[model samples]
Target: MAVGQVGGLLPHVAVPSTMPAFLIPEWGLSYGEAGLMASAYAIGYMLAAPVLTTLTDRIDARRILIFGSLLNALGTVGFGLLAEGMVSAMLLWGLTGLGFAGAYMPGLKALTDRLAPGDSSRSVTVYTGAFSFGVGLSFLACQLIADAFGWRWAFILTGLPPLIMTFVAWSLTPVTPAPRAGPLLDLAPALRNRTALGYSFAYGCHCFELYGVRTWLVAFWGFVAASGGAPLGAVVVSALFTALAMPASILGNELALKLGRHRAITLVMLLSAAVALAIGFTAGLSPWLTLMLMLVYAFTVPGDSGALTSGMAAAADPRFRGASMAVHSTVGFAFTAAGGWVIGVALDMAGGVSQPGAWALAYSVMAMGAALGPVFLWWSRRSGASS
Candidate 1:
């Protein structure tokens, strides 16, 4: 189920990379408009997470996962076959995001409910680590399919895997009894847990930085690849970097255990922010060097992902697991959308996409959000203790 959960995301992330070559040119949309359309997916995710995932407290989460997977399959297929403009694309992608809201958190709840606390945390780390591989595959798959059979075919064919995943999850995954929390929609328990809320809100800051980086990474690499006359394409390099960096999330969770979650996340954010701070200034440097630095940023940035998630899930009251996840996704995805949109706006402000300095400033904004994460956690801790 975990593998399938990750498998489903493989094609979704591909849309960003393909939009430049396929969607924007064909649909006659600017990059800013395209980013906004992409933000629609985040909008859907934010809207759907609390309502859909909360159902797990009443019914088996496997059922929710199945429903979500079906929606994902339908949405992806709809995007491929029927979408003709930004509006249609936004609707389809939003539908897909609805599917993600159901699948991801519910899948986590289903698995964690059956495990020992220590084991559950480890499982969360490993499971979230699969996201890196999924995103990497998305980039690679989109490029390969688009090169062979055009971009429409790319979307159409890539949509099939999640459908297969729907079947895999429904037939093969074990069923667990529903968690009997207060009511199906009860979030009060989760909301009242200061620790859980802190971790969740911290996750929001991390999401801002993470999504911003992932969405624009290929675009940034395009300039570097062109400047170097590199044989490898931008998507390929970005995909490889994302894949190689996948294990860092798991390793980081281990660090959380040793150093404490807040400290570990804070340290990682500072390091990543430093890289984001410097990458822009060196925009005119050698493309090879730029790629190396991007790889560094990729590794450092994702390192805190699993740690943040594990911390939140661990701190949540058992009665409000679903609700905790609900708050986590709602806040996290709100920033996810904003991250993508702000990156677009940031690009426009920096003097459009053509200028190196603009790209430099835009890149800096991506990681700057995370630099505040430690401070947020520290202040929360102090306030709670004093009160």
Candidate 2:
């Protein structure tokens, strides 16, 4: 479970951390164009998630996981080798995104199915923690590699870990028969569940904020490093905050298990929103202060992500685990693409003005999304529906 999750999430974190800046000069992309490139991946992810999950129901998850991991690795390496222009980059990114969709949710279902049929929350926590840890580790590892070698090597390095993990999962995961279900019937009812819809909305908002931040954090820090004349490494500084986020994410799940998922998610959302508002108002005060606020926001924003997923899993019909997860991934990542594009638009509109202020405004919009997320979750709970 850990290996699969880490493999799945490594690309999630590494791409956002490195790609925005890495492809900039190489592809001669503007901020909007870079954002679109990121969106290209999300678009592919959204499109493939459901189809792959349906496939998982017919194929053994272990086999699906291994194949997915190989695809993910192949896609990443292919992107590194073949992406030479804007169009080509988008095409490759979409393929990489398709690979990601195959790996992430299917991998989770594999872990969940393997659970020992007791209170699965603890196992869920561990799996989710691996995801958060992988994201943070990806940022840290990729940043170091990018600094030492180059962005191409960073992709190579990120791709290798998953390829290795693929074999590990194949060797370790117990074999099981493919689940039986009518694919359309299994998926249709999930779409109508109000709580599920609400959870999906909150997740979308969370992704809107989370992806916006992840996609831009290094660039934001780069701007800070240049303007402040700070001696810190931009990527390193970004990695520290991202790494701080991992524990906070684990803690959020723990808190949610104690407090009701809705309440815990609401609290985290509010806190993250406040931090975003603070950054918007005070970003130019001092570099350390600005980074500090961002760190605080980062820690809180993603903390509840696992809780949200776990809640969705619990709320879902046991028979439709794969479909439910597919829905979850599709909704979350679709909104993520929107969030990236929106931030890019905000940045473009800000033009040559204070770049930090522009970024602050963009980030503030993300915070608003975070704030609004809880309302949907709360509504779901009040409606007496399971997410």
The 10-residue segment with the lowest total lDDT in model 2: 177-186
Question: What overall lDDT goes with each candidate model?
Answer: 0.79, 0.76
| TM-score per candidate, chains pooled | 0.95, 0.92
Over 4 Å off, model 1: 171-183, 385-387
Q: For model 1, how does the per-residue alpha-carbon lDDT over 73-130 read when each residue is reduced to its tens digit?
A: 7787788888889989999889988988888888788778767876887899888888
lDDT, candidate 1, residue 174? Answer: 71
Q: 6-58 in candidate 2: lDDT tens per residue?
A: 76666655556665567776666777777888788788889988888656656
Model 2: how large is the Cα RMSD against the reference? 2.2
